[model samples]
Target: MSRPPSNTHDLTFYNGHWYVPSPPIVAVLMMPLAYLVGGKNISTADFSMFFSASNAVLVFLILNKLVDRQWIKLPRKSILWLVLLFAFGTPHLWVGISGRFWFVSQILTVTFLALSVFASFKSWSPWIVGFFIGLSVSARPNGLMSWPFVFAIAMQVMREDGQTIDLKKMFAWSFKSAIPILIAVLSLLWYNHARFDNYFDFGYVTIDGDPVVVQNAKTHGLFSTYYIPYNLRVMFLYLPEIHPDGPWPFLPSGAGMNIFLTTPALIYLVRRYEGRWWILGAWAAVFFNFALLIMYHNTGKDQFGYRYILDALTPLTVLLAVSLGKKIPWHFILFVVLSIIINLYGANWFMNG
Candidate 1:
């Protein structure tokens, strides 16, 4: 139970105001709804669920457009299946249900991720793409990693259209595009400065609060070689604890499963695949986020799966949608079905536990 400006997940007190390390876009967006629904009575869980489900619909619409634009082609059934899988067959269901401040960042970042892709494909406007990607980074700082991928895709699109690589024009366009993003990044820095007097501080100080995280942050400095193995376990090898005593097979607290185990469709990533601009961008985005997660001190405990990957799910799910448009070997489909069952089971167990 956090006070007025404080958050349940992470909050800092300074000069009679509560400060949260996470970026402000989610709170900014929620202000309208909070006002409408009576801020004191509104449930974050409900808002998170609504936003999470809405993201599913947004993905479906984006995918449908992709299909129409011939970026990827699939029968209507397969298209719908992929959308459903993305919506329900992931840790997002559990995270959405949790509805803490941290989960709000996750939900918002993923939505921004999808919006960036959607804008890129729809208009290829450098300004719009940069703006959305900037918003994504504002939602989750790691989203800044997407910059290279976004520009790379823009280059690829230009080439595909037989447009010459005009360095001056491109620079001009990118510079103009970056204006809004720069303003946003600066605003976040200002927010941090206003709270902690350090432009870069996200309030991860042992002196402030949250002992465990503060200690971990102090020890590892947030990212370090020490975190790799433990993170690997969280990302690829962890499993749920089995508790036989509960009415149902309730999952133990702090348990987690690897994406491969919980969402097996990622196995399809091993197979040979065609590479396009968006696909390459998607892969780049995934790799960047994974690399960041690998070095971070926190492994996102008390989760069904690595919920940190929710932000990356936009690109990852896009990759899955592209896969579906292809031949979709039997094994891939089988893995997807298996993933659905595992996630469903995991969600139910988590909720009941």
Candidate 2:
């Protein structure tokens, strides 16, 4: 164990021990499977199937919840269409296909976020929803921002079912929900202290990697506004490259693509959506995640179509479903199809290009 490994990219050496700079939740989840499969025999690609399967099933459950709770809502055709769209039309598909360490973590992060959202809508125990929230944040610290949306949905759904959220019950539920999140936070703090002798430093600036990235992290420090312009450019403005020599008309750059360009169906979000109080919390969650992502030291490396958007995808999809209601409009179908086609290329690029 004391012998050093050859590859040190993103690995840190401190006090005669080595550590990797990543959240360990998803890796920990995979350890049992790895052991059973004789670890070395398992291909990395197989690990990502966990996310691809989870995303498809979670989309079905989230959409079906509307009908399960009350009204005999959308037809089978519409539900199937949405499942296809969600599985193909967003970063979810490509990220799972990639299965790089960062991308795999995103897979689990998005999965837990969807589970947390579903628990809120299903009006499961507030404790369960909070547990999922803890799981998400443990996967990626940014996921902590989504707890507001989950809590609001839980309270509002209970009220809709005519269960009173009296002050006593509210306090009790809040306390219960907060427990898991508190535990997750404390665990992370302990991990950081063990690794770096600090409660706050997750060691991004100290991580070893590509020279350009190292310089940027060292120059501006992590989470500086100085990094916002490049991040915004990649996340929103960068488009398909018009290549002069390549046979393909447009080349997919490693730089991320515009969010709306990738998923045009989201344009409908500009229209008047239903006036649900809890949706404010969902939108708040999206904005909060976006603000932190854009200010981070790096946009992303070797990505297609703004992978960071996965952080807010659950709340955004919840808002979009409410906005569209039961009817599948012609324009909505057109946009979703376009979004799927775009992501088809993204998935191809991620796997083979």
Strongest candidate by lDDT: 2
What digit string (tens of lDDT, one per residue) describes model 2 on residues 1-353?
46777887777776677787777897788788788987777655667767777877886887787556533256645777677777788888888877677788888888898898888888788789889988888889888889888777777787888988888877887898889888988998888998889888777777777677778888988788988888988887888888778755567667678888988887777767555646777888999999999888876766778888889887777667667766778888899999999999778877777
Q: Per-residue CA lDDT of candidate 1, range 1-36, in tens?
A: 335643334666666666676788888888897888
Model 2 Cα RMSD, 1 decimal: 2.2
| Candidate 2 pairs with clashing backbones | none
lDDT of every predicted structure (CA atoms): 0.74, 0.80
- Cα lDDT for residue 315, candidate 2: 75
- Candidate 2 accuracy as TM-score: 0.92
- Name the candidate that leads on TM-score: 2
